[model samples]
Target: MIRDVAVLALEGSHAFELGVFCEVFGIDRSDDALPGYDFALVSATGDSVSTRHGFDVRTPHGLERLSSADLICVPAYDLRVRQPDRLAHELRAAAERGARVLSICTGAFLLGEAGLLDGRRCTTHWRYTDELARRHPRARVESDVLYVDQDPIITGAGTAAGVDTCLHVVRREHGSAVANTIARRMVAAPHREGGQRQYRERPQPREGTGSLAPVLGWIEANLDQNLTVEAMARHAHLSPRTFARRFQQEAGTTPLQWLTGQRVLLAQHHLETTDDPITAIARCTGLGTVDNLRHHFVRRLGITPQGYRRAFRAPHNK
Candidate 1:
């Protein structure tokens, strides 16, 4: 349902973060069979805004453009510089009027300044989590998550996490198939578990552990199998305990947790794109029975499988 989109082009905004919004929402991708958004870059005074990287971003739009926006994006900006006062006030008012607001990296500072972070769970880049917490005492800033989605307010951790956040919005509003198509166009992951914790600043994986790409790919191809820790460990040529530890190191999640997330994602895809019965979808996704699939869909997405299909089934399928 998110059609009208406006990005707040604040002065000194980081170009890449702002570009993230543009790449996700600004482009005309209808040729690829994806939905097109009414995307615009709006500034405080309808003037050009200079980025931190010395380039100027301009659009014939201002804060007035936000009044009709379904979603507002705030990208990373220099925290040391003060922003226009009206930006914060209007943002607060927009969210009050049911407009979802998303922040990228230090952009969470603006939401904090607008008082939107108060009493809400949010996150920023790991390097800035402590600072965000210190600035907004009432905000429950989670340190390690890729992003935090508390309905009207979504916050991304850092640069690349912005893609994850925006794709999530598309997935939530449209359906997994649409989101996945958009992600494929961008050559990015269709989904990354938001709860997957941020890894430490390590240059490389620990000495003995090999890359996990093959194992992950194998897991996806074999989701219908009775996968267990021992089974996966053997495939990776490691003991169960070591495999668990190494998976945590490389993937930022336990193997089983990641497996469950993939199953849920697959089930979502089936629900949105296929007319298969719930039990059949469950069997294919390795969720076992209808009860198990419904339990996970409700717990993770707060919607029943049948409800999800009714709400999000492809137009052609319907």
Candidate 2:
């Protein structure tokens, strides 16, 4: 029933986050055995708008297109700009008429500006949680989750979390099968759990400009291996305590927590893409046993691994 989607590219938008909307909703997936969404990029003026990334995007439709949309997305934009009364009015009008309104990253700032977030539970990027709260005292800003869907109003965390939000919308609208299909085609994991709390730890600064990037890359590639803090610290030529601290600083989480999250992500990818049995996938992802994976998957994603697989797997595969 969610046929038409309209994304509002406000002035000073972030290109990558806006592109997330397009990639999830605008791209045609019918050729790949998935349903397609009718998506449009619109602006207030129906003109070319510049993004924070130094690129311009053109929108043929103006605010008028928002009236007929089943869903509306507002990508991140500069909050310092003077909010136009007319634009805020239109956004509220659309939401009042039953169109689902979503915001990606700092786009929640606009919703706050429009007064839509007042008394509603929402979230924004972790970096802006304080600011969002300070600006709109009535809005309850949840900084932990990747996204919050308060029925018709939804808000996502920063950057890549926008993809999760969009796919979530797809899942809620069409079904998990369609959303997972699209995620596979895009080479993105269909689900992440435990919210942005997992990303709140500050990573250590680079060791004398040597860059922890290589170390992080190595960890990702060797996720299946026993990745104890001692072993990882030995690899980095640091004491276990220092390594743990640095890992948290560099990776934004303790090594164990980060590893668990990565393994969970890998498990989710396998659940959505491969026909491998849960036991096999669990072993491959270093999750020990099917029971263990099931526990963690359920705890994190709010569903058992089998249930997730059943919801996302193609009919024939299921």
The estimated TM-scores of all candidates read: 0.95, 0.69
Q: Report the C-alpha lDDT of model 1 over 225-269, residue by residue, as the tens digit.
A: 999999999998999999898788887888999999999999998
Best by lDDT: 1
Candidate 1: Cα lDDT at 283: 98
Off by over 4 Å in 2: 1-3, 11-20, 29-35, 44-58, 62-64, 67-70, 84-100, 113-128, 142-152, 156-227, 235-237, 274-280, 289-291
Superposed model 1: Cα runs more than 4 Å off:
200-209
